[model samples]
Target: GGIITQTPKFLIGQEGQKLTLKCQQNFNHDTMYWYRQDSGKGLRLIYYSITENDLQKGDLSEGYDASREKKSSFSLTVTSAQKNEMAVFLCASSIRWGRGAETLYFGSGTRLTVL
Candidate 1:
């Protein structure tokens, strides 16, 4: 696997504003996923795509948009930012073959702040 790069290490936005985060990977993995990690909580899946141009909604898919732009890139957008909210958005890519053992690589994460 290769490295995953996320844009805007720290993002600040106002309440009710829309925000977008981008991720890029060189691994060319079979699947890519977007997850939200909140304080003191486990990661919650926002979206995932098994291939290019494919979009699949997960638990936190509401109020967000996701796109698998190409084999090496994925993006996520927040439709509306909540007031005084903070969270870390994580991007991950994995190669899952028949073995059921997938190799996953993750980006450092994009920190979001809504004032």
Candidate 2:
């Protein structure tokens, strides 16, 4: 079995500050992703990388940036946190998809709040 770990279970930042989050997975999967979940917005993708050094922008990448520095590690940075913003950042990995969306395993999650 494999596991995913995320650092800093809670993150608090000032408005307009750049905040970074890190994730590591032992699944050895080929694809890793970062998504943001708001109170009612469901899950919105921020970025994904199919392999090491590869980067793909998702539906909600406007204010975020991500990196796949290695096969088992992925990180995300909020360029500028908004005032009173709050969301859960989820990190996930998959075994790669041949056609449709593949099943992804996620970390516990990192909660972020901007004051």
Candidate 3:
């Protein structure tokens, strides 16, 4: 069994400030991803890394940055926090097999609030 751990379970930021969220997984998976969740909406991929030191931008990566310095960890940063906004950042991992089935294992998440 494995688990994903996210640090700073809650984050508070001021408008225009930069905020960072971190994630670590013991799943020994080959791929790691960061997602953003808005209230009442589905998860949107922000960034993903297929392997260490590799990064790929997703649909919502415009206002964010991500890094995979190690195989078991991934980090994300919000370029500029918006005022009075709230969102959840989720970290997930999956095994890559050519072009086959993959299941995402998600972390509890880091909730962000901007003032």
Query: How many clashing residue pairs appear in each of the predictions shown?
Result: 0, 0, 0
Q: Native-vs-model 3 lDDT?
A: 0.92
lDDT (10s digit) by residue, model 1, range 1-115: 3799999789999989999999999987878999999999999999998888889999999999998889999999999999978999999998854586466689999999999
For candidate 3, lDDT tens digit of each residue in 11-32?
9999999998999999899899
Give the best candidate by TM-score: 2
Give lDDT: candidate 3, residue 66. 92
Clashes of 1: 0
lDDT of each: 0.91, 0.94, 0.92
Question: Could you tell me the C-alpha RMSD of candidate 3 in Å?
Answer: 1.3
- In model 1, which runs have C-alpha deviations exceeding 4 angstroms? none
Runs with alpha carbons beyond 4 Å of true place in candidate 3: 97-101
lDDT of 2 by residue, 8-102 (tens): 89999999999999999998899999999998778999999998989999999999989888999999999999998889999999989776558
TM-score, per-candidate, Cα-based:
0.94, 0.95, 0.94
Which candidate, 2 or 3, has the higher TM-score? 2
